[model samples]
Target: MLPDALFSLTALLYVAATASFARYLAAPADGMDGAKVAEEGRRDVRLGTGLLAGAGVFHAAHILVFSLVLAVCPVEGIHFPLSVVAMLTVLFFVVLRGRFRIDAAGAVVAPFALSALLASRFVGMNAAPSTQVRSALLPFHVAFNLFGIALFSLACAAAGLYLVQERLLKRKQIFGLFKRLPPLDALDRAEHRFLLAGFPLLTLGILSGTAWAQKVEQGGLSDLLRAGFGWATWLTFAAVLLLRAAAGWRGRRAAWGTIAGFASSLVVLAIYLGRGGPGGHS
Candidate 1:
């Protein structure tokens, strides 16, 4: 109950932050100043970011206390996958936003965090798999998968914005929201680095997952489907990285690849969370 209360409070903070960021992004371009107009709305962005940071603090505390009370590993349960995903995605964005100059991306991140937290509240909690969690390698697999998915989500957000900004550029319409997004090259580079950072973790997760599946005798339809998506996701991102290296694929092509890869990961996540799925969260 206490964890629920904390989670509710955190969700509210995320909602407020989402509203602030939306307004910040959609604000009128009045009072033209020679200084950077993005700076003009820094007040809203800063307020929103501060609130979201506070929310993240409470979110972490909620997970810690909740896990302790349930005697369950937060990362090992199907119930908390969405919550962890959203939390890591938003907090990671907060850390890297300035570095990447992708403040506008918060428009997507805040609502996503809020939605995930809400979903966690309403959904029934699934206990960790007995046989799966007993393995010594389980923690490593879950940790790497969680962190990898989080990074991939952030990368997809950047890539999505890149596509929008790229479209606006091609249309020669650079007056409104287009001005707010990060430069194309910056987004591309950020996506690339994020993929690079996450790919190794993904590799480790897949390898460990395969071993655990074998140990647990998990080869059902849901298990196989989840595995398929995991491998497909790995391959998709791998190609995205390789093509970028070998064929100079950096713009629209790369964004598509990132989005496709993330979409496949989402399928894997969905399968894990629903019906007769694989062991615990993937």
Candidate 2:
């Protein structure tokens, strides 16, 4: 009951945040006075940030209570992956939005978080791992992967915003959301830094997952597909970073690569959810 209540409140918070961000992005800047538009944008961003922060707090509580209610470890099954990932993503956005001046990116973050949160509620409720497949490394593998996915979510958001900002700049449409968004260079840097930070964690997750798979003798097609997409995600990010350092790939090229890598990671996640749960095939 407590978990349910917390979940409801969290959902409402996310909805409010999403609305605020949408308003900020969609509000006209041409007809309105420049000062009024700037003020309104700032107000909306602050409200959205605050609402998102509250949502994160409630999300954490919901996870804890939900895990307790089920008497299950949060990291042990697919039940919490989407929820945890969403929560971490929101928390990260709230924390770094100011630092990175990416508050405008909340337009993406809020809806994604809300959708993931709602999806987590309906997916994998009955799935659990058998005793034979359980291992000490399983929790670490899930944790690392979840955290990496959260960071990748942020990178994708920044990359998406960078693309929009770049398009507007190219076309010379600089009035509305363009004025509200962070600079193009900042978005690029944020995307690159997020990828760099998440890469090592993803590597650890892949290594731990491989060892766990070997231990469990998971040789099925689903396992193979998941591994393939997971590696594809890692390789894509690696190439993006490598090219950026070696061949001066930044801006649009790097943004597209990050989006592609994030899409691959989502495919891996979809495979997990499709199997009923992470533990279902373990």
Candidate 3:
């Protein structure tokens, strides 16, 4: 019951933060020559940041409580790890806000807040083996994959925004949105960094997954299929890297690639969940 209440509160706080972020992003940043747009943007950011900070505290507490309940690291598996990843990203974003005008970037970051909140709801509801899944190699795999996906998710959001901004730029109709978005150089570099960091983690995840599957004594075929799908996701991300490196895929195409890879990985998760996930029909 306490967990449920915490989950519900976290979700409400996330929704509130998302709304505040949207307001912050949607507020005008243009025509500051004589207008109060900067003041308004600052106000919106302050409100949104405050709400986001509150949500972050709740989320951190939830993880701490969950860890205590389980008597293990709260980031036990893919799901819990994802929640941690999202939480850390929020932390990073908050810390960086002072260095950069990232208020408008909230629109790019809020979905992660929502995702983390949703993931938190399942923390204890699932009856799967929540014991410490310790394999020295396995932990490495999970760690890399979690960070990779977290970074990629951020990239996905930024890429989506980049596409929109690029389109508006190409169309030469960017008076409003143009002023609102981050500089094109910033967006481009962001995409590059995500791919640069994410590609290796994804590669390692694929390798570790294969190693884990090969060691399985039963359900060889099904496990192979599952791992195959994971590899497929890895391959897609690899291609995204290649494209970004060699073919110069950016903006809309890069965004689609990231989304596709993430979706494929999600399908792998769905299979896991459907078979025997926490609170899943096992």
Candidate 4:
């Protein structure tokens, strides 16, 4: 219950920050003409960043509490996995903030929004069954999968934003929205880096999952179908990577591929959870 309260508060703060970031992006400073608007935008961005940072700190604290609770009690259901995903997603964006102008475009807020929505689903859902596994490799497998999803989810959000920004640019419809977005090239570059990071991690996750399944005699035809879906997601990304290399697939198509792949992966996760995973929480 404490964790839930902390999570909800963090979510509300994030929603507020998202709004502010949107405002900052919509209004950038021009020399003399838009000076006042730009100043206000800057203030909004600063405030938004501060709020996001606060939310992140509180979010980490909540997770720490959850970790302690799980250590003493049984870790239940989708909440833990979803919480881990949300926390890591925010962490990844925070790291990228140091290197990119992503803050200017409100990219940080979107992932939090996604996380919040996903987490909230547990409000009414049944708890996941806790299963004990005694293997050194299990932790690594879980870590890789969670972090991979975090990276890909960010890429998905950026791709969505890129598509919108690209379409607006192509149509010569520069307005408030245009002012708020980063240059298209930068978004493309960031998305590429995210994909590069995510694909390898995802491969590790798939390999680890297969190994775990095999150890438990779970590698039958059903496992094959699940693996196939996982591969399908990977192939989608591979195709996007290939097109990016040869045909220069830059914007919307790339984003769409990321979304598709992530969605498929989520479905696979749902299946695993529904079936009661061999040792991990089902």
Candidate closest to the true structure, highest lDDT:
2
Best by TM-score: 2
Sorted on lDDT, highest at the top, how do the candidates line up? Answer: 2, 1, 4, 3
Q: Is candidate 3 or 4 superior in TM-score?
A: 4
Give the CA lDDT, 0 to 100, for residue 271 in model 1: 80
Give the per-residue lDDT of model 2 (tens digit) for 132-166: 77899989998999899999999999999999999
**Pairs clashing within candidate 2:** none
Give model 4's clash tally. 2
Error of 3 at 190 (Å): 0.8
Question: Residue 164's C-alpha lDDT in candidate 1?
Answer: 92
Q: After superposition, how far is residue 225 of candidate 1 from its true place, in Å?
A: 0.5
Of 1 and 3, the candidate ranking higher by TM-score: 1
lDDT tens digits by residue: candidate 4, 60-124:
77777766765522123344556666666776776685475665645455446545545545531
lDDT measured at residue 20 in model 2 versus the true structure, 0 to 100:
96
Q: After superposition, how far is residue 160 of candidate 1 from its true place, in Å?
A: 0.7
Poorly placed runs, candidate 2 (over 4 Å): 32-35, 279-282
Model 3 whole-model lDDT (C-alpha atoms): 0.66
Q: Which 10 consecutive positions of candidate 3 have the poorest summed lDDT?
A: 273-282
* TM-score (C-alpha) between model 2 and the true structure: 0.97
The regions of model 4 sitting more than 4 angstroms off are 1-5, 25-38, 72-78, 105-134, 219-225, 276-282
- The TM-score measured for candidate 4 stands at 0.83
